[model samples]
Target chain A: MFPFRVPGAAPIRPHGRAADEVGRLRRPFAVVVYLQSRDPAHVKAVERRTMDKPTHLIEFETMLLGRHLQLSAPRLRRNNQSLDRSAYTLLSRIRMEGPMSIGQLSEAFGLDASTLNRQTAAMLRAGLVERIPDPEGGIARKFRITEEGGRGLDAERSANISGLEKVMAAWEPEEVAAFAAYLKRLNTDIENLDGRPWPRP
Target chain B: MFPFRVPGAAPIRPHGRAADEVGRLRRPFAVVVYLQSRDPAHVKAVERRTMDKPTHLIEFETMLLGRHLQLSAPRLRRNNQSLDRSAYTLLSRIRMEGPMSIGQLSEAFGLDASTLNRQTAAMLRAGLVERIPDPEGGIARKFRITEEGGRGLDAERSANISGLEKVMAAWEPEEVAAFAAYLKRLNTDIENLDGRPWPRP
Candidate 1:
């Protein structure tokens, strides 16, 4: 679905969970479609439409992930770098799926083998992850989250929750709950679109 | 607040009015409390905690502004590149106060004149805004929204609405109304934080 390929990046694998969520959302399931005649203008149009419509924004953010770094900006400025979705996806997977092989990571993210190599290279340089020889095979490699990565993830999670807390400081509990429910659904839809199974239906 | 910057092009600005609308939904109010701590990690930690909450994701997107391709990954691609929140602040001013002078933009965004010059230079190069020689004071330049800038704003608005629509596709009219009301209040709170006068309040 992505037009340009990041040489060393992997596509995030959706699995059945995401698929199920998307299915529930698109009940009678219309075939997924894209605008065929695409140019900078068309892409811009799509972006405009996505931003204007809340539903569209949710879908686009969940799928394309527009603002993953909003919470982490200040901290990231030390290095003057922000983690994009590709790397974030890897972090999320490692956090969610535990340790896995390079091949598995590649499949999960739909990234080419080489892309994973480059991404992993960066992650390794950052000490976010570590590589160990594969137990299954001598030549193959397996990656596991490092202590630093775990700490970073936890920090990110805490920051995320804290950020939410401040934003809703004046919000009623009911309002927060309603929005949370919507967020939950949005997350589910994103997972489904990524080919993961939905929680419901 | 980010652990690492995304290495690559800057985040894409929202394509049009839709993007502007989306930006509204993406955040709520935040108190810009100055930090006494000069430590980068400490500042980032505080910033992340204050901005990373799940509910605040929308707001974080705009504030962090990685989604618009203005600050996040785009700035980090090249080493030694620095990003200040001034341009984004200027964009916010334009959105809140409508068109004004570079001086006005500078004051509203809390930026120095030289900084605005540098920012406007980059902005003009990107074609997101235009330099219209100020009519009131011909000696000064008044930056105005270009057609491309308008389109970008529209794109953001559309993307935002699209996200909401996805969530609301199954909701009843009343549910939509309820959500809209809540959203309106939320927007008001955010505007208050930004010191902008709200129409309803």
Candidate 2:
């Protein structure tokens, strides 16, 4: 049986003649048949089909990620670097892409200008980013990552990756690769649907 | 070339004599060699090693997820249901696990009791949850999801799931499963490291 039921498929009859037959055959032949059918390719296909129909898992992932962020918010600061995870991320973005106008940042991050303004303001106060004339000669000023900000971002990134490495230490290398590929793909698709959050440098 | 560069490795000599050699190899042989070397198992291992060493991708995932949540937050309300994503998730927990005391909710969510208190108070004001006597004879009043809350939750869940489906429409079923599984594992590990939020029913 598949791990997840198909979304609108007929409900499995729990106590019918079919069920009785399944129960009776459960010990030997059924086990043999199940094992025989579960070759690597077959198992992969089945797992794929099971994941295709339901939105529950995706929704659950979103909820869990949100909660994880909330749970970790307080601990985001480290070693006198007062920037939170979002701030650190912003700094990293600027570092990677060079200076960007607030409007451009808002577009890339899918956030309101006001929210970005507040966040950037706080970052400015901390000297993590500074406004500079747009190199492209645009009217709007651009924000660039400061040297201090670069160090802070490096610290936070190292810490986060170290934490992930520990959590994933027991996983197979293949599993880690699949997970990373899938996550990257998911983000790519999301960016396609919305707007690209991180333009390649 | 791998999708991600290995951390601490020397940068790809993009403009060196080696670059000229690689460029001279041209399309067919170079493409064939690249494809052959990217066997599923080999690629998976490479990806795993890359992810293990770099915090950039992990940090990017975190930032993307956080931004996605913020982007989706304003759309959570519909009709007369005004619950935010966090509130909807909280109500769903109550619905799934039965009535829970504020203290229990706090512990489960890894949040301060005062935060839960304020959130629950808002839920009460919205009539999404109601105070009830704890069935287990606990002194603190427990919170139960109201019928209206259930309906609101259903609406919000459907909307969120629909959005995810659209965003993920182009993804392979295998990709979806891998992403979901990885996300779940990540959350479980995070919970273990910190404190479990949302006990199993």
Candidate 3:
């Protein structure tokens, strides 16, 4: 799923739950008898139709997911653990990759320099991050996560995990792990295509 | 995954990909043999430790996924076919469940009446939806998709599908279907928990 594999990254394999879901959805629709004919055109048409389906479903489900996030995220914020999403993500990036200048953040996140400047300024005002002279003595200042920032990110992350745990309460551990792996893969591929790979722990 | 299954909803089975990834993550660390000994304390300790892991990964990756969406969604808007996301989703809901009043949308999405009012008002201005007297002659006016809205939704949806196709270009059909199923299940569960229960087509 990732363009460059981590040296010892875990491998994700296909599982049966998805097969069962897909199979059940298909069974009520039609019974397919594979064509024994050697006609390439007929085979190609069938392949094309099959290929179109999953992608379509993925597109629709993701749209709904965005809606789900819209609804759930606000509810999550009623907890004192709430950290605005951009701030949380920015803190996470700094936590993972250490302090970085706005320019570096812009490059890593594909954001405009102005946007990063505004975002970092907000982080500074919120005490989530503080500016420091470059550790390597570069002219540009870098933003570093403060202890407060770390606590806030950790707290918000814990809340998020708790929410997911509630959602997946009935899932088997293997199912939870597999779904996570798939999400990681999907994000990695998106990062890969955008040429802005996010660092993983 | 859902509190209530649709009359004939497909069943999602747990598949191997997740197990493989989880197993690999466990390897290079330690191996455990299930103790035949009847010590409940040891068994409980092992179970607790095992339970804590994958949930953490899922939480972190989901946060990262949010970051990716922030980065990618704007780029997606550059297309002429672009429809604002809320507008697309609103049109889609109306398309699926038929035109609905502000109260119904608020209930279904858990949004404040003021928020849905503002959203529908904007959607009205954009010509993506129109106000109609409730078909049942109810006093509350409902929003219905315009033909233009339908066209915009379809165009944006196709673009979304194309983008996902690029992301999953190397994925097997089964993998794509499974991931979609996972997403569907996840969203359904979230909706169920929220008591929103988004209609599925």
Instruction: Summarize candidate 2's per-residue lDDT along B93-170 as a digit string, tens digits.
Output: 888899999888887787788889899999999989999999889899999999989988888877777777887787
Q: A31-59 in candidate 1: lDDT tens per residue?
A: 12212323556544543432232333232
Q: In candidate 2, which residue pairs clash?
A: B108-B197
Residue B155 error, candidate 3, Å: 1.0
- The runs of at least 3 residues in candidate 3 whose Cα sits more than 4 Å from the true structure, single-residue gaps closed, are A1-47, A74-81, B1-47, B73-81
- For model 1, the local distance difference test gives 0.48
Ranking by DockQ: 3, 2, 1
Winning model by lDDT = 3
> Candidate 3: DockQ?
0.41
Write one digit per residue (lDDT tens) for candidate 3, span A135-164: 999999999999999999988887888788
Candidate 1: lDDT of A83? 50
Better of 1 and 3 by lDDT: 3
- Compose the digit string of candidate 2's lDDT tens values, residues A1-201: 433333444423322324333333223333333334536566345334333444568787768778776555444334444458579768877888889998988877767899899999999999889899999999999998889888888776667666666666676545655666676776666777665645643
lDDT of 3 by residue, B20-101 (tens): 3334334222113212213556545543564454788877777777775545755633476577777888889998888899
RMSD of each: 19.2, 10.6, 12.0
Query: Residue A178 lDDT in model 1?
Result: 69
Q: What is the interface RMSD of each candidate, in Å?
A: 9.4, 5.3, 2.7
DockQ leader: 3
- How accurate locally is residue B86 in candidate 3, as Cα lDDT from 0 to 100? 74
Ranking by TM-score: 3, 2, 1
